[model samples]
Target: MARIDTNVKSIRYPVPCDEKLTLLARKLKRTKRQLFIEMVDYFYRSKKDPADMNDEMLKSDLSRIGNRLVGFFRTQESELLVPIHGMAQELVGNTETVKDELKSIHEKQGDAEKLLRENTKHASEQIRLLTSIFDGLAKMEEMRAGFRRIMEGYIAEREALGWSTSSGKKDELVRRFRLKVDRL
Candidate 1:
């Protein structure tokens, strides 16, 4: 069996006997045990050798880390943020130009549609006029045919009655009718 010291029986360690550790605990207004625990925890968490660290060395190391962080942030701003900001501005400009062109195209399309409607209306009117003109010509041709049929009937009756087909009075009357028809 192993023999354990009286102090080590409960805490598993002997109390420190350093004069500086005692003075530092007094100055820091903490118990010697608390100070020792805090020092051990700090060295363990920081992964730094307590024998190699002092106030000046810690400050220099912190300053170097701060400078490296600042330099990294600056590089990121130049490489990524600057180009992204420029692309955003260019996208805004291009969008405005495209919107203006689309608006112009829409206006031109509206004007073309209006012109097409007007042309269609005009064509319809012309078709109506042409239809009326053709109807008038057909009615005139019918009247001319009826007048010829009546004249032929009259000539046939006179010929069957053994009357002369041409006479001076008839020729004068025909000449007067031709003049009236020409005037009409």
Candidate 2:
């Protein structure tokens, strides 16, 4: 009796005598079963009729797909890439403007700080000069007070002794004045 193999099943299909299917399978480095499965899947996925796919039809289909890809790229470039490029340029320009403004502000700040320092220095010098002038004036006032007091004391002493404080002769006063003027 012949043994039955439970793990295998078989079906038969007819083909032309030229063996084109076998040749295509060998050229594509796939088994006949794998080739048939792939072909069936491709037809199902693409929804294309194999009977309509001659060389000219294939070329026309590829050209149409190529034109669609080109259009999609052009749309994306116009809608996305071109605007992004313009925005990038505008951003760079804004950055440069901000930098220039910052630099100008920094320079102005430095100048203002320098001017404040110079003004402070000038104010301090003026304060010192005023202080010196006030000190000199205070000393001169003290000296004038002292001289007035001494002159009053001398006049009182001379009056108590019944003598004239300004008893110098006219000739003596004139000689004294002439001597002082000569010294000057």
lDDT of 1 by residue, 1-184 (tens): 9987655523444445567777899999999788988998997887776666565667889999999999999999999999999999999999999999999999999999999999999999999999999999998897787667656765665566454646875665567556645644
Give candidate 1 misplaced runs (Cα > 4 Å). 1-45, 48-66, 164-184
**Candidate 2 lDDT by residue in tens digits, 31-84:** 887888899999888777787746565688999999999999999999999999
RMSD of each: 9.0, 8.2
Q: Report, for every candidate in turn, its global Cα lDDT versus the true structure.
A: 0.80, 0.79
Off by more than 4 A, model 2: 1-71, 164-184
TM-score of each: 0.55, 0.51
Model 2, residue pairs in steric clash? none
